[model samples]
Target: MAQNVTRAGKSRTDFRDAIQPFLAPSLREKCATVLAGSVPGLEEIRIRCGRPLMAIGGNGDFFITPQGTISQSPAQAYLPDREDLDRSLQLLGQGSAYALEEQLRSGYITLPGGHRVGLCGKTLVESGRVMRLINISGLNYRLARAIKGLADPITRYIVVGGKPAHTLIVSPPRAGKTTLLRDLVRQFSVGIAELGFPGVKVGLVDERSEVAACYGGVPQMDVGFRTDVLDSCPKAEGILMLIRSMSPQVIATDELGGRKDIEAVEELISAGASLFTTAHGSDPEDLRGRPGLAALMEWKVFERYIFLGRSLGIGTVEKLTDRNLGSLINDKFVLRPRPGSGD
Candidate 1:
């Protein structure tokens, strides 16, 4: 099984183990060898029918050769056959694709260890809605690793005056927004005792099963000691439900967009619950162009706006700003690491 240590210093899981079951036999063997060998910073393992097998790590993307070494040329990589796709579907479905039709329609499946396999294929549409993906062509097994205590540097800003601020984390895709958000959730769940912040009830709306990465109704990740998660639920609906029933001091979710989402955020704020969520963007000005986000900014829904990017590393804090769009901190700020935050 996967083994990961939580931000609260608890053991959880590893991505390679979680991804093993979904890989075809030959590819699985290759990946196992790669993992067993020293492939520093290995992250994603890619499989495509007509293309070479690829592996992505901290250095960059490269093709995986038959000898388990990084291929300098794509031509040196192995091309997975059609049977590999069939086997992958069956394994990912745990025997039958019919069992996971709903998740397939969403273009991805959330595996047990919070690992996600994104699929690409011809879209089957019925009555203007996606039915499923047929003739599957490609799969990207994106690795999910939680860097425990990554959020410690920003805890002081989040927990202000013994209460969590309405925070909105902004970043472009793959900028570690989700990872940062997850760590923040864990910190909120356990609270920073050194900072005089007590653990409060946090309701997490994991719309894509990405936040808490719950498997079979239980979180594979440690969000905190006091966190209630609504997995794979619609953002707007989940937000309302969490507020009505969970009595959370803070409501956290991922990828906020759409009118209903904005309405839900307003409702939660009205109900006296602090909000924590993320959006896709480059910087603060990028948010102004997006309609739903622009509305949130206009309403001043969030008290703090944190901008994350890949400046120094994946989870680098690019900028920190207030609700009024005033700058607060930059990447060079001297942030002391907290206990258990892996200084």
Candidate 2:
């Protein structure tokens, strides 16, 4: 019954009526927190203990609980009823609740709250892949909050033809570029006015689903009416897929680099749709020196590049210099020092 699906051809307006109700008052709070922690001065929250009945999200580098906590190792999740626990264990064995409890004591689980839980004990693997863990440990609960509309400030960068700017956001490790990209996507999907970008089609190539957190194909958060997300697909292939199938006006992806990525963007651009994406780098020299990005950053292909930093995720903007003319327009961060002003 949960909505906010991450399908190729699905539009935001597609499930507006069927999905909103599935958004229990609490789940919405959790989604809000994740966005909040990504940016400063956005929003804040206070959790009341023993309020939410959490579930298991998934098993990643660690076990992620529905509450949003990525666990220390792999944490066990409990059910409300004792019978359920017993039944689960009987059917799933170490994968069951009783077994989970053992793991819980020393186990870690990532909660929907964004906090993580850590666990202890033996590891289970099959053919080099982890099956699960046994013997639980303590659980660490992560809290999630909202940074209300943080991306609202950067809407100007993507406006094209007096419309929303078609932008590509770039940054280095843990620079919060993905978080920024997610928010910007939300703003765009929700529709904007300044550039007549209202209800503009945005195709999200969510290779990891981390951006939208598409749980069981349903987006955990709200994006907008014109958005279509293709979760767990390669960026290059997904771009081409969306371009050919979705008919989106704009294509969006995260952490793009390499010949294929650049080639795909060129394809999208040539097809007349603008692109929004992200990458890793500190400055022009760093970006230009990078193997894959150096070529794309040339400006002839990718028009606008937004660089993100710790303080302001999107700390700077670099215009691609025309390979022929040799100057990137709008390539200034915080506006270059005006003329002859003394500091």
Candidate 3:
């Protein structure tokens, strides 16, 4: 916390100016984590209040300092220079935002789950082509991870013959579904012989670095030695690409929607790759009732759907539903439970 050199009085304004929308105390800890190169499971940096902890690392090597000190490298700080912006623009022009993102991640960068940075700029499209973007502004450095046992909450519900079923995890906003998915990836990745499946070959479609955070063609997170991730590719294209090349036993992704993505899900399942995904919804009905997910429900694309929520400020397993079982929660229509069919 003392890392903030600014004092009270006029220094408060300077602190506000320098600080990136978070308190100095938390920033110091985040800064330290970023410098460390690898942040452990489920860490993230967000904008305003809410999650207490803020954003984190990308799938690239983090530097605390661009220029090395007599004892260490320079600490990570925001880069708003036009020279850096120029480089970003040039790289982006070639549809190489991933490369540009890697360049910006030189030092003191945050990396939770080995996740990479989220960049923003003006769109550069021409005649149905997304050429690149210009005027880079605002950076969202993400932490990547493969936290073992993150799926423990639903560990009891997901197993089918000792292996987690073809599962769909659902949550709203930031209820930790991706975080939970990240955990499942780790669990599946474990090189276990007795887990029924020996050395599961897992494929992670991390278009947004949700699992297997990758930076510059290298994985920043340990998503299991058996895992292969397609970072930054469109979800549908990435799925097709994985099936074509990776020969995966399981395919994992975050935030599913769109006809193309659903089609890919169907295609993969047809080939025998179990699909795991998350979407922004609170319950199974909320997901099933949605126009997009309704088709998947009709096709029974997912064997299980895990609903997540925060209970008393801690993440909780709110519900789990199957096509036959209907609502796993005691009360589906209301938050409080009522007399149920389970007796």
Candidate 4:
């Protein structure tokens, strides 16, 4: 138990170190102080000019006081000023915003450790599209975490005959779909020894830079040796491109929506490559309600469907089903939290 606690502490320290260089002095100190406690489930740190400094954890959202203590009332919280935001942006961009113009145009920047900072403010629009963001007023620092063995229990359902099956993970926001997808990619790419599944080439289309979290064209997370990541590329284009170029046996992507993405999935299937992806929904019915997914469901494109929820815990696997929506598992499976996993 003590060793587990120590491991958790080290994990928190690593998380702090990853973001410290990008924070202003004052904000950094406050964050460090709060992190020194037992906030193991810490997920996001939100900083907004003229608004309360807040930290979101698994329990709920709470404001951080100037003394680095949690507060329920925003009236007693610390408010980040213009200087704080400016200094943070400067540090995040390495003192030059122009160098990160493309990332800013996408409204977020992926940090060195795969942590993401989401930006919000005025937008520069041209030809019916947003060119860039200016006068940034808010920033959401989302911590990146890789839970190494999170996919172990579900590997049997996803891998068949030493190859990946067509699977779609369904979950609401913050239900660990992305984390599960990341681990599945790693396991499939690196081979699961226990299951006697040999590694296969995996093409990861990380559109939001969340799954693989590439930094400077390299994956910051441990995706796997045989995985090839197309960082920050659109899902549709990336899928087809990988089919033509990488010759991957399996293609994994996050959040399947939009007609173009569906069209790309069809192309991937037609090319005989396995597909592993995620979508935002509560259950099979929720997926059927969505137009794009409904079409895919009618075609029986996905062979396995995994549903995740927070009834028991954040990463609980509420149910597993076959292509016809028949129950595959009789009991709910809860993912055990690894020390310092922050899942």
Candidate 5:
């Protein structure tokens, strides 16, 4: 029998160790205090100059008070000042903002543990191009996490006849599409022992630096021992490059919607490399409405379509269908808990 895989414990240790060190001392203390208690399903930490410190979690968005308590009233929350933002920026840049010029121009920095700090500020435009960001105003710290075995239930549908099927994961924003895709990459690269599949060479094009979350060319998240990542590279170019150079058995990338991206997907298909990718949509009609994606659907490019949503909490596999969009299962699939989880 295939043993049921349980959801991993939600711990804030990764966030505390990886992200807190870069926060301003005072702000760090407040965050640490809030995290010292039960985990809040924390997803994002938003800090804006002269604004209350805000955190977004599974439950919803809430403000963080100076005493490290969650507050519904923003008026009572701790307000970060100019100095706090300045000091935090310096720490994030390691005392040198100029050193992160390229990342700043791109408006985000990938931290050590795959955590990304998004920057929004005044821009220095030269010839209609943003040279760099200046007078930083806000920062959104998106915590990166890996839920091992999260893809266990869907792996069987993904792999058929000893090979990965061309699959497209559909989900709205924050609906766990990226998280699910990340786990899928890890499983395919490491191989699913329960399904008698061996690990294969997997190429990952991290266009947004999210899937693999590479920092300084090293993947902080576990994508599997056999995965090769192309960090911060465009999907179209990176896909073709991986096919010619790495000869990956499967090529995974995030968000496919552009004309060039579709063309590249064609190349990947022609080359006989399996594909694992995601798109921002709730259903098949949403995909058919898009010009680029509509063509692929007409051609039946993907063999399996997995729809995800938050109806049963994040990472919920709402539905699974075959190429023809016919239901593959009669009922909503629920993740089984491991023995003694007490759920």
Candidate 6:
């Protein structure tokens, strides 16, 4: 998984700069120094009220000390008070809470660089609905790293007969399904002329801003030149909209299932668009047990199923099967170096 270890086109400063705006002056300076000296695997930066500032990476979680060094022991960590959290939220919102109310209600805010800040706060309820997130207590900064060639291993199976396959990627959260899905879109959109694959139109439904990581109607990540993205749109609605309007040859989305999503998938497939989507599951049985998924399997909605796990770090290929449950790739032969497995 050396590919996963390196950021490819991105720099360490890019990740640090993305999250810098959300930090208080003192903490930002401290973290900037730590980030400058840190390795490339920093995946997340965590901030909490009255708690120590922490950063997590492929190596493991480490606290950012006051002296701007990575410390295994929390004793040397930089602790921020409640006032810092307030200031951080102010910086995050940019003095316009009303403008970000919708994202706040969703418990996350997408920064310009596609970095997502997950909010933990008291829920303000109104008529059985969460109207707002108030009294923000903690924030989790999930850095977005787009690796260009992450889909190289699976491209052979997905691109069959000179067209994108109806593929369904399965993985638990943070297992890199979204990253893989994004790269697949990029590969399909850009195409490999030398490999005999021509670039095709790809319609992307980025419901949670995870795939395209769009900011202000523009994609922060490279989703390929021919990809059309509908950002922050519901999966079901966006799929139908893309099929009807964009007339995409390949329709891609992330984390799909349920009656509406399944129904929409059927409609898109029937409209002659190949489907590429991901779901949360560890194995085929998990996919079978998931409500509404059995119907999809019965219909053979997905022609290729790619299962991902963390055994070999993010985007590890655990299994690849066809519609009939026949193995397409030998799972044992797909091994990559797992995390913490020394080079």
Could you say which candidate leads in lDDT? 4
lDDT of 2 by residue, 124-243 (tens): 666985556643222222222212244544566556565555566666664446656766777677676545666678899987555665655666555556789997788999999999
By lDDT rank, best first, the candidates go 4, 5, 6, 1, 3, 2
Q: Given candidate 3, what's the lDDT at residue 124?
A: 67
Q: After superposition, how far is residue 35 of candidate 6 from its true place, in Å?
A: 2.2
For candidate 1, lDDT tens digit of each residue in 57-153?
Answer: 7667788887767776999998888998889878988888788887888888878767788998899899999999998899988767666677778
In model 1, state the lDDT of residue 135: 88
Q: List TM-scores for all candidates, in order.
A: 0.93, 0.54, 0.63, 0.94, 0.92, 0.92
- Winner on TM-score between 1 and 4 is 4
Off by over 4 Å in 5: 1-10, 37-39, 126-128, 334-343
Candidate with maximal TM-score: 4
- Model 2: lDDT equals 0.51
Which tens-of-lDDT digit does each residue in 1-343 have in candidate 6? 4344353545666767777878877778778865564834777888887787898887788898887778898888888788878888889889799988998888988888788889998999999999999989998888887777777766878877777889999899878889889888988898865468998999999999999899898998889899999999999999999998999999899888868998898899889899889999998888888777878988887889988888877667888889887888755334332332211
Better of 3 and 5 by TM-score: 5
Ranking 1 against 2 by lDDT, winner: 1
Candidate 3 lDDT, 47-68, residue by residue in tens: 2221122333222123332222
Residue-by-residue lDDT tens digits, candidate 5, 1-343: 0121113423556567888888998898888855553326778889999899998877888899998888889998999999989999999999887799988898999998788999999999999999999999999998876676667778888887889999999999988788778888998899877789999999999998998889889998788889999999999999999999999999999999899999999999999999999999999999999988899999999999999888887777788999999888776654433243211
Poorly placed runs, candidate 1 (over 4 Å): 1-13, 333-339
The model with the greater lDDT, 2 or 5, is 5
Off by over 4 Å in 6: 1-7, 37-40, 332-343
Cα lDDT of candidate 6 equals 0.82
Whole-model Cα lDDT per candidate?
0.80, 0.51, 0.56, 0.87, 0.85, 0.82
Candidate 1 worst ten-residue window by lDDT: 1-10
